[model samples]
Target: MIEIDNISKHYVVDGVAIPAISGISLRVEAGEVFGIIGVSGAGKSTLVRTLNLLERPDSGRIRVDGSDITTLSKDQLLRYRRKTGMIFQHFNLISAKTVGENIRFPLKLAGEYTRAEMDRRVDELLDLVELGGHRDKYPAQLSGGQKQRVGIARALANHPKLLLCDEATSALDPQTTQSILSLLLDINRRFGLTIVLITHEMDVIRRICDRVAVLDRGVLVEEGVVADVLLHPQHEITRALVQESCPSATTGQRLGLSGPLFRLTFLGAVTYQPILQRISAALDVGFNIVEGVVGRIKETPYGQITVQALGDAADPARIAAAFGEHAVRCEALPS
Candidate 1:
């Protein structure tokens, strides 16, 4: 639903151009959750802001469902933005407004609904975000998670076709973050809304993103399915991000295992099967797991294990072939 083509953005400081993002390009398919991840100052926020034209790129085109948003007229852009909603890291609700008013604010601004209609829509959004009982509460009276729920309810007030989340859950605790992510996922499935979110956490991407793009120093370093990128990261930056989320999966060398080490990747149904035990028994080889991680990427179960094959008869190529027959990927790792 969203296509960003060779977009570049820069800022002028002391009459010199400082790049925020350069030559970044990616796509977000309809009804999917796409995540852009990076460390601080990696231009993740800058890239996401460009989607809503909050920060217009210095060069290149941004097309949403086939229309070049970069070239839209001011009036046209205003109308376009109404169909796209944004949620922020810090809850951007009006302090004086109650939860109900905060949600009603968007509908009021759009001038597309009557007073009774806006009130009914506000109630529906409140219920959707599970804040029906807290509608009368002010921002100062709510918890961090509650405030964010209000922010989400307000973002969805106008029934946006696309949602832009800029560090939407970064400010919350782990439990709260998971709750918010679950809500976003439900929203995506229920409304078929396309979502583009930016975060510095790999765990967030693993939890909800269908695809992810890694950003580093204003460059698009890597991009792919969450399962593929998390299991076998191709870029150094991507590996580091994955390492932060699952240390054992990336730092197998630290395990201090003797003999030849191989990294085995299991996906889908194979992740649940006793592939290693079966392979070991069939080959008359003993398998010692040095380090391992088993978890799901979105809804797909996967496992990445670092193991050592024992016994003199255990040929590396032959052992790898045995695992391959069961739809497992085995790669020799440095000991």
Candidate 2:
């Protein structure tokens, strides 16, 4: 329901122009979770802020549903922002306000709801975020994850159609991040809210995003389905991110006992197939399976293995050819 068309933005630092985003266009479908990933200084935060016109672009248009947000008047922009919720890396809740009061702050600012309506909405959001029992507690009283739940509840107080998450789970631990991601997935399914998340973590993208766009040096380098991009990344930067995000990985150089290192990737039903056994029995080579990760990106199952061939039969090209013959994908790594 969001369309970003050829948007570019730059900043003038002491008479020198530095671009934060350049020639970027993206379409986020309704009721789907879309993720934008990049390392630091890649402008992920800047791009998400552009969705609500928080950061005005130097060139091009942003359309939400059908309205062009870029051309909206100041008052119009304020009204439009209420329909777009934004949560920050730091749980941006008022320290003095209780959880219930924080959730009701948006409605109060709009001055549209009565006291009874506000109370009902606050409780509803609290329940939605599972922070109902903490309504009376202040932000200081809650844990990191709990504070984020309050932030989420406050963002949804106005029933926003679009949600912008700027590294929402980056501040939490691994377990807390998983819980927050699960909550976001549940929220998307239940409310049919269109979500655009910005993260540097590939794990987050693989876990919940339907589609992903990779950013590097302010340029949109790669964009595609989560399963396709996460499993088989085309860009070097993306491959590095994937390797870092994997459960366990060892470099050929680190082991100091390498000859030919090949990465075998099994996709879909092939991941469930016993191709490895058949290949081992047929080929005259003995394969030493090193690093491996067998898991799902969203819902598509994939298995990737690093093989170190032993003995005089260690031909990387031949092994790759064998995998290709069986319709399995393989890549030979640098020594």
Candidate 3:
């Protein structure tokens, strides 16, 4: 487990102090796929770097597995870094080294494995990343996805319990991104590896992350299970992220078509109800569904339907409250 308590990092540029993170705190559970999401310069990059002590925080404490890493000495910090491996967005494999050699770089640097042992581990890691046949191939010879697999293999070289992925798939195409995400999920399940993935892409988080933290301008706006956060985002930033993941979930005049707007979200038992039928039978409201989509989050029934509510009701608030009681999230839009 990792506990970041009130961590802050600052930089000096031309004699003026600039704050990157301001007293941010978060907890990453063991064997959990946790994500930190934000736009560029939201301090997400700086925060991840702080995990491995790459960007030392000016204040507060960092604890990993009950050890206060923030207070560690130089030698202690080096060992701590080895225990937490990092992967970058660019799949930073050494162009000069073969796939096998790149995977063994960390082990070589630590000087902790024997020749025979290293060879065995390299073979095992290559197979782990599903690149066993590409051991002798150089970075230039492999495709983008293949290069990232090599990067994954190399990151696991030292057998780190925690893996930090800094925008690991932001550069890939959608299909390739999904593939890489699936790989990360597999790695987490197989090794009980605790992964902290930081990205601006919400799809990456929605696909595999168990829980997520949304950061906006260095502040943690929201954090919770991916499904819950996606279905019911508490912060504006989190809502925007979720909306981006499911563009069909949007409200208002859609695709150049002008009409009244309604936002609908279904969860639990209410999701199975024929909402249109219920609305017609219970009230004298007409609906022109502008746009809608039904999607799942972790196999949980979750969806958003947008409809333009028409006609008048004797009790508008009462009807809405009744729908709300059924657990079907609903909101009316203004013209």
Best by TM-score: 1
lDDT of 2 at 132: 78
Error of 3 at 1 (Å): 1.3
Query: Which sections of candidate 1 miss by over 4 Å?
Result: 249-253
Q: If both were scored by lDDT, which would come out higher, candidate 1 or candidate 2? A: 1
For all predicted structures, in order, the TM-scores are 0.98, 0.90, 0.89
lDDT of 1 by residue, 26-142 (tens): 999999999999999999999999998999999999999899999999999988889899999999889999999999998988998999999899989989999889988999999
Best-to-worst order by TM-score is 1, 2, 3
Clashes of each: 0, 0, 0
- State the lDDT of candidate 3 residue by residue for 23-113, as single tens digits: 9999999999999998888899999999999999999898999998888999998888888888899998899999889988899999889
Q: Model 2, which residues run further than 4 Å from truth?
A: 247-260, 282-285, 309-327
| lDDT for each residue of candidate 2 in 1-335, tens digit (9 for 90 to 100) | 88899999999999999999999999999999999999999999999999998899999899998989999999999899998999999999999889898999999998899999999999899898898799899999999999999889888989999999999999999999999999999999999999999999999998999999999988999999998798788998888888789844446786565688777888788998888878777777788888788988777788888888776776777778889988788887766
For candidate 1, list the clashing residue pairs, or say none. none
Better candidate by lDDT, 1 or 3: 1
> Which 10-residue window of candidate 2 scores lowest in summed lDDT?
247-256
